[model samples]
Target: MPRYDYRCRACGDTFEVSRPMSEASESASCPKGHADTVKLLSTVAVTSRGGAVPPSPAGGGGGCCGGGCGC
Candidate 1:
């Protein structure tokens, strides 16, 4: 299941839902009785190996250290 962010166009309320991807389009509504809610594109945080990997520097090679350091 993936968490999705939504915004209520009728009530200006924002909320999150955790469900299967197939349910996203059908489960869009505001808890405040607003039916004009829409899904909002949002960013999600991801961690691997119990650590967060930082983004690579711009204009650098495809390596983690930005270049070959032989570390």
Candidate 2:
């Protein structure tokens, strides 16, 4: 199941709901029983289970294609 955040336009209430991916697009009701709600554009941050995130290849100190280009 995936969790979704929704905000009610009528009551200005915010809530979260968990449902199957297939029903993710379905309308969510607010705590005040308002069906006129909209899904919020939320951000999800994923971190590696192995602690620190791996550095980007482009961020490598100073080697261009393994020093072949000698840049």
Candidate 3:
């Protein structure tokens, strides 16, 4: 499930809803029962599951100067 943010123009409040991605485009009612709401643009942050990424290899990583072509 994914969460989406929405702003209620009539009540001047913001709320969140959790639903399937297929229904993400559907309108959401505010918590105050206001039907006049607009979906808000949200940002997503991605991270590695291990909490850290592997370091890059030496020799500048593979183009022509990775010590294979002697550059």
Candidate 4:
């Protein structure tokens, strides 16, 4: 199950619900029992154990992959 954020227009209330991806577009009833609600776009933050990603080489690189063409 995935959590979704919803905002009620009738009562101006916000709530969260967990449901299947297939039901992601389904309208959810607010806690106040308002059916006129809309799902909100959410943001996700990603982190890696390897730390930040390294910057790519300037002006691109060799025609080969990974700039390791021995140019």
The residue-by-residue lDDT of candidate 2 on 1-71, one tens digit each, is 78999999998988999999999989988989888999999899987889987665754555676544755
Please tell me which model should have the higher TM-score, number 1 or number 3.
Answer: 3
Residue pairs in clash, model 4? none
Error of 3 at 49 (Å): 6.4
Candidate 2 residue pairs in clash (backbone atoms < 3 Å): none
Residue 23, candidate 2: C-alpha displacement in angstroms: 0.2
Across 1-71, the per-residue lDDT of candidate 4 in tens digits comes to 89999999999999999999998988899998889999999998888999888888854655776566755
* Candidate 1, 1-71: lDDT as tens digits: 78898899877889988989778677676888778877888887766886776766664675656666654
For each candidate, C-alpha RMSD in Å? 6.4, 4.2, 3.8, 4.7
lDDT of each: 0.78, 0.86, 0.89, 0.89
* TM-score per candidate: 0.57, 0.67, 0.65, 0.74
**Candidate 3 positional error at 9, Å:** 0.3
Off by over 4 Å in 2: 53-71
Q: On residues 1-71, what C-alpha lDDT tens digit does candidate 3 reach at each position?
A: 89999999998999899999999999999899889999999999888779777777666667686656786
* Candidate 4 segments exceeding 4 Å error: 57-71
- Native-vs-model 4 lDDT? 0.89
Candidate closest to the true structure, highest TM-score: 4
